[model samples]
Target: MALRACGLIIFRRHLIPKMDNTAVEFLLLQASDGIHHWTPPKGHVEPGESDLDTALRETQEEAGIEAGQLTIIEGFRRELNYVAWEKPKTVIYWLAEVKDYDVEVRLSPEHQAYRWLGLDEACQLAQFKDLKAVLQEGHQFLCSTAP
Candidate 1:
């Protein structure tokens, strides 16, 4: 069976006179072990929990962000399938906006560090083709809907 995970692609719009894709920043957390890869808040899906529930719960546990503190963007979701440790893995991500850019991020022991970066910087840090694509698509979605 494939391992399933869910997460939120959390982003915040920086308040500035000129608002564009560059004004958006995404939240990424560095793993505490292995390659120490950076990824958005996510975790394995617990038995009996819905995918969105897992995403919200993981976001809170991994990034100190609660469901109430984020605005879930409708119509934006991505699923990635890959191989990890000789097994198949599937991850689902939903686009969400941080209600306040100033909210604090408290990392759990599972992660050693966290950063909020623009699309280019985030793609550089993500260092994975699928994740980079997800970030790019999220940025384009936000840009297309911006006023």
Candidate 2:
């Protein structure tokens, strides 16, 4: 079976009049292992855990962002498939917005560093094609849905 994991693509928007999605920034965590790849916080789903629950749990564990700290944006979810460690892996992601623009990101031992970046830099650091695509999609989605 393919390894299944879920995570949130957490973002925050700067508060300013006349600002666009350009004010938005995404949170990425650098893994402590394996080429030190940077991606949103995620982890394998445990037995009996729902996909969304796993996503929330992993975000809290890896990024120290509690569920209460962000609002999960509806209507924006992406799934990516790839090979990792000689095994197929499926990762599901959902968009979320931090309630506070300056919310703290406390990284766990699983991750060595974290950054909040705009779309371009996030995509560059993402490196993987699929992840870059998802970040772009998420950015567009936010832009289109901005209030």
Candidate 3:
């Protein structure tokens, strides 16, 4: 059976640096185990949960950022498939924006640290190809939709 996970492609406007525009920053979390890879706030989906619900729940559980604190972007959903623990895994991501500049990110024990990074840095830290692609897409969506 395939493992399933979900999370938000969270970004804050006007926070990215070196882009000249500097209006979008992305969120990434460093895992506490395994390869110590960096990823968005996500984890295995609990039973009987909608994908979006899983995303929302995992975001809160992993990043301590609840649904009420973010505005999920409209018309954006992405899926990625990979191998983990010798089995297939699928992860879904939805674009979301942090509603307040001063809101603190409280991470759970599953992660060691979190960082808000701009396009280049975020892509670099994400490392995983599929994850970096997702971030790129999310960043593009934010840039195109900026007011």
Candidate 4:
């Protein structure tokens, strides 16, 4: 069976601790192991959990942020598939906006660092083409609708 992962494309706006229609920033975590790549909070799905549930849980576990703390952007989801460890892996992501605290991010041994980046930097560091494309699409969607 293919490996499955899920996560949020969590973003903040213009230095405010709230979600706004303009000036967005994105959350990315640097991995502690493997190639040490940066990405949105995500992980393998566990027993009997839905993909969306895993996304929310992984966000909380990896970034110290919870689903209740974010406003999920509606009508936006993306799936990426690539080979890892000689097998296919699929990752699903949803866009969300941070709304409460800017608490210090906590990383498990799975990640070594974290950053909140503007769109371009986030895409550049994302490295994976599918993820970069999703970041770009999310930014475009925000810009087109922001007042």
lDDT of each: 0.95, 0.94, 0.88, 0.88
List the lowest-lDDT window of 10 residues for candidate 1.
14-23
Quality of model 1 by C-alpha lDDT: 0.95
Best by lDDT: 1
Which runs in model 3 stand beyond 4 Å of their true positions?
15-22
Better of 1 and 4 by TM-score: 1
Q: What does candidate 1's lDDT look like per residue over 1-147, in tens digits?
A: 999999999999976665533489999999999999999999999999999999999999999999999999999999999998999999999999999889999999999999999999999999789999999999999999887
Write the number of the candidate with greater TM-score, choosing between 2 and 3: 2
Which segments of candidate 1 are over 4 A away from where they belong?
A: 18-22
Better of 2 and 4 by lDDT: 2
- Write the candidate numbers in order of decreasing TM-score: 1, 2, 3, 4
RMSD of 4: 3.1
lDDT of 4 at 140: 92
Instruction: Tally clashes: model 1.
Output: 0
Comparing 2 and 4 by TM-score, which wins?
Answer: 2
Provide the TM-score for each candidate, comma-separated: 0.95, 0.95, 0.92, 0.90
Worst 10 residues of 3 by lDDT: 14-23
lDDT of 1 at 106: 93
